[model samples]
Target: MEGHCLCGAVRFSAPDAKDIGVCHCGFCRRWGGGPLLATHCGTSVSFTGAERITVYASSGWAERAFCSQCGTHLYYRLLATGEYFIPAGTFESNDMVMTSQIYVDRKPDYYAFANETPMLTEQQVVEQYGFPPEDAKS
Candidate 1:
């Protein structure tokens, strides 16, 4: 799958689309500049015009890459997962994307799920998705 930033300054491609996870945490909310909708692609995810992609250490264990030109919140890499969480909105076409929303309990109270997609709380994430709370400190 292929994706890019809003200004077309940064581009990336992923060989296979798997190991995807959706994050609804507060940091994700702030870093993404909105609700974060992401998918975990491999480290092989290559970038074109790479210099335009600036990275910030969003957490102790992960970094977020964004388009410096347009401030487009692009993707994040979890050191433990060895996977890149690419924003679904950034993809050319998010046809094959399937997300299991995590951090539901911590999600903003203003919003409610209207879709049938499975929603997971923080504990559920730790238990089922191997997401350790310790690594999530922002």
Candidate 2:
């Protein structure tokens, strides 16, 4: 999948992108004003105009990045596995399906998705991903 920032200052491609996942964690919500709709791009992403990207260490095990020029939310990366969960909107268009959701317990009650995806609570995520309990910051 190919994508670019709002201002076209940073472009990227994830050759292995297949599906999208939702993250309802507080950090993700705050980062983009709502839950994150992203794709697990593994570590096969390539970039152009890298200098326009800015990264933030969101937590001990992961970081978030965006385009400096337009502040377009980019990707959330796991430091341990070098995996990248890029925002779904970053791509121009796609056929990727949303199959899973994380931090379901933390999702607010005001809105809900119609998709019947498999959802994982924050605790379940910690256990499944082997993430430190204290690393709930994400």
Candidate 3:
């Protein structure tokens, strides 16, 4: 499926993706207004308007990308693997499914989902997804 930024300056394509993952980490919440709804697209994803994309090194292991033209939250990427988790909203599809959530312990009490999805806390996310080496700061 294909997705684009708010101003259409940054467009991406994620092939054969249907599952949406929620992330409630502090950085994700503060990045937007709530949990990040994204799809793991891996390196298989491709982007257009590369010049308009600004990537911020949000953490040691990951970077966040957005449109320089309209500041649309684009994706969270792993520095080591070039993997991407594109924003689900960008896909503009109603068929997406919420299969899992991460950084669940950091989720605020004001909001909750009824999806009954499997959740992983910060430690579990680190263990399962893996992170950059100690010296590999992004």
Candidate 4:
């Protein structure tokens, strides 16, 4: 799968088009400007316009990449897990099949999950993603 940043300055590819979902954490809200519609791929994901991709160390273990020109949040990387979580909206097609919403408990209180998708809480993240308790404290 391939996608580009809003300004078209940054582009990336995901070899396997699986493990996609929405994240509703506070950090995601701030970085993504909304719920982070993301998809997970291996570290094989590469950037084309590397110079335009700016990274922000969002946490001790995670860093987020964005388009420097347009400030479009592109993806989040978990160094330990070697996972690339790219924004779904950036992709050309929304053919993402599997999904598992993370940080459900911390989701915005104003909105609710109207869809029938499975939701994961902080503890679930710790268990499923191997994120430690401290890491899941968002």
Return the lDDT, model 3, position 12. 83
Q: Give the number of the best model, judged by TM-score.
A: 2
RMSD of candidate 1 to the true fold? 2.6
TM-scores of the candidates are 0.84, 0.94, 0.91, 0.86
Where is model 1 more than 4 Å wrong at Cα? 16-21, 134-138
lDDT per residue, candidate 2, 66-92, as tens digits?
999999998899999999888988897
Show the colliding residue pairs in model 3: none
- Residues 43-120 of candidate 3: C-alpha lDDT, one tens digit per residue: 998889999999899887889989999999999998889889998999866698999998898899999999999999
Q: Report every candidate's CA lDDT.
A: 0.76, 0.89, 0.87, 0.79
Provide the RMSD of all predictions against the true structure, rounded to 1 decimal: 2.6, 1.6, 3.3, 2.3
Across residues 1-138, which tens digit of lDDT does each residue of candidate 1 receive? 888888888898987564345677878877764567777777788889888888898666888888889988878888777678788788887565455788887787777656567888888878986766734444
For candidate 4, the lDDT comes to 0.79
Instruction: Supply the global lDDT for candidate 3.
Output: 0.87
Return the clash pairs for model 4, or none.
none
Candidate number achieving the greatest lDDT relative to the actual structure = 2
Residues 1-138 of candidate 4: C-alpha lDDT, one tens digit per residue: 888888888888878675568888878876656778788776888888999888888787899888889988888999788688888788877667646788888787777655668888878987987766543444
